[model samples]
Structures are given as structure tokens and as C-alpha cells.
Target: MRRALHAAPEILANFVAPYGVYEMLAAHWGDTDALIASAVPPLLWSFYELAKTRRVDAISVVVVSAILLTVGATFMGGSARLIQMRDAMVTGVVGVMFLATLGMKKPMIFYLARATVARGTADGAAEYELVWERPGVPQVFRVLTLVWGLGLVVQTSCMCWLAWIWPIGRFLLLSPFISFGIFGLLMFWSLGYIARRPAARAILAR
Candidate 1:
């Protein structure tokens, strides 16, 4: 995710900016065609990336939301601030989804982790099903889901605040770093928590 986010600016500069392929086409063919052509590939690629995984339900939500945002941004004109909001919107929706899953059979993280292990390891999905039913497992995932859901909401609010106050160029450049920083922090915290969590440790030890 970090690598992909970092590469985006370069991709835009190289392929979509002035004298770049998209811009060159836009110069002759016009903005609408250029925009569609430029956006479709990335959108399709995003879906393709998600399709490679087995977690269809969660993956579908992410990919669909992304495509909707990309399309919305495309037609919403080229304002950098609005683009930033659109990105935040995706985060917000994802956050809400995470929270909503607290009422479901499993939290979002459980499905995500299970799918990852299932796809990456032999017979891991069945083991995951068994592990998921163990004592204390559901509560842990529910708490985690709540934390991540609220965390994402907070992250989105911060991004929106920055977009409101900061220059577009600066926001565009700095916002990703802020997000990466949050993600890094959360990742470290999750790792530490998991290391100390007997249930998580037990699952892994299997």
C-alpha cells in the first residue's frame, strides 16, 4: 500500500501530466476522452488486484467504493481539494463498514486475516474457522474492529481538515505521508498487541 501510494505521483507525472500520454491525447482528443482513458486502467487494475484474493465480500466493497470515488472525482472536475475529500470519503466509508461489522457474525479484520491466510497457506481457511470460534476470539476482534473503525474516522477527519486549510499542492504531497504514518503506527501497535495476546499467539503457534 505504501509503495503504491508513493508511486502514484510519479505515475501521474509520467503518464497524465503535461506532455505525458494522457495530456498529449487530451491536447488533441479533449479532456473527457483523456480522463476516461487515464482513469479506467487504474480502476481496472485496482479491481484486478483485489480479484486475485479469495476474500470476495470485503474485497468487493473496497474495489466498488474505490471505483465509485474514482468516477466521482473524474466527473467532479479537477479540484485538488475535492479530490482529497473523495479519498477521505473512501476512508470514511471503509471505517463505517468496519464498525457495522461489529453486529455481524465476524468483524472485518477476521475476514481479512482469514482470507489472507486462506489464500497464502494450504488448509489454512479451515483452521481459521476453528480458531475463530475459540473462547475470547470474537471479543478481541470486536474490540479491534471498533478501534480501527474509529481510527479510520479520525484519520479521515484529519485529512479533511488539512484539505480545508492547506494548499492543494502541499496537501496532496503531505496527506499521503500523514496517512502512511498513521498506518505505520497502527501496524506497530497491532503487532505489539498480537504479540502479547494469548489468543493471537495461540492461533499463530498452530
Candidate 2:
């Protein structure tokens, strides 16, 4: 038990390193103590709960920062910049997570969405979503995934780019507006794409 406990950090470090965030976050937080404090709880409560002991040990650091930004935005209402930066942070984190999922060639979202759609909740009241996977939809599904990934990259890039060019205060102040705009635009674009897709239409009809 002591050996396992002693090895926990290294085990976590090794597991998460392949996902490409271990060093970046370590650098950002720097101090191991601080990093552990800030980073571990979220992972423990969120990701770790879903895994076996030897599986992935750490949640994405990007996710932690994103949570900080979101909480800060809510609490720091006087500072619109915090809110904008918050938007950026949240979007950036989500963007990276989605990209990582893509990189892994994992279909976490596709499966979850299918499960939700097909069965709804276990209770009888849930609307039945069509669970059928037609051959025709894979092409569009792939395209949609690409589009979503690209959209996240674009939004994160926008936030980071603004962070660089604008004064720190300005970036913070304007981020909310920019973030909200991007979000609404993304939604519209997604809606249009889905609305035109035969699979989506077929799903709706079912």
C-alpha cells in the first residue's frame, strides 16, 4: 500500500503525459505542491471516479484551468475581463479535450450521445432516440467531428490571439463579448449543418 501510494504521483504523471498536457501544466503551475492541490481534486472527483486504479490518473490540466476561469467569472462579476478570459479559458479547455478525444480516435461523444438518444433515461418517460447506425451517416459524422474540432481550435486561437494583442485589461474586458459571440455563431453553424443532414432529419422524424 505504501509503495502504491508512493508511486501514485509518478503513475499519474506517466499516464497523463501521453495526452500532451503533463509538462505544459507542470510548467504553468510549476510547484508540485500547488499543482497537486489545484489539479488533483477535480481529477479525483471527475475522471478518477470512472476509472480503475491503474487507468488514467489525472484529469486534463486544461480542464482545471477552465474550471478556475468559469468560477472566477461568476465570482468576479465586477471584472468583465475576467469573464471574457473566463469564456476563453473554458472554450480553450473544452477545445483541447475534444481534440484529445479526436487524437485518441475515441468516440466518447458519439457513443454517449447515441445512448442518450436511443434510450433516453432508464425510466419509461424518456423520449426514444433512434439508435440505428446507418452506413450513410459515418461520412457526415466524421465531417461533423472535424467541424467541431476546427471550431474549437478557431475559438481557442481567437481567445489566445486576443490575449496577446490586446492589453491585459482589454483582453479580459472584451473576452466575454467575443466568447459569447463565438459561442452563438458556433451553435448557428452547427444547427445549419445538422438541419441539412439527412441523418439528423431522420433522427428527428423517429
The 0-to-1 C-alpha lDDT of every candidate, in the order given, reads: 0.68, 0.50
User: What is the C-alpha lDDT profile of model 2 across 44-101, one tens digit per residue?
Assistant: 5444434432322123343455556655544544333343445455666666556566
Query: What TM-score, over all chains together, does every model reach?
Result: 0.72, 0.48
Compared with the true structure, model 2 gives a TM-score of: 0.48
How large is the C-alpha RMSD of every model relative to the true structure? 5.2, 13.8
- Count of residue pairs whose backbone atoms collide, per candidate: 0, 5
Best by lDDT: 1
Clashes of 2: 5
**For residues 16-80, could you state the per-residue lDDT of candidate 1 as single tens digits?**
34224444565676644554455555566566666666365555566677678767766676554
lDDT of residue 75 for candidate 2? 51
* Candidate 1 segments whose C-alpha is farther than 4 A from its true place: 1-48, 51-57, 202-206
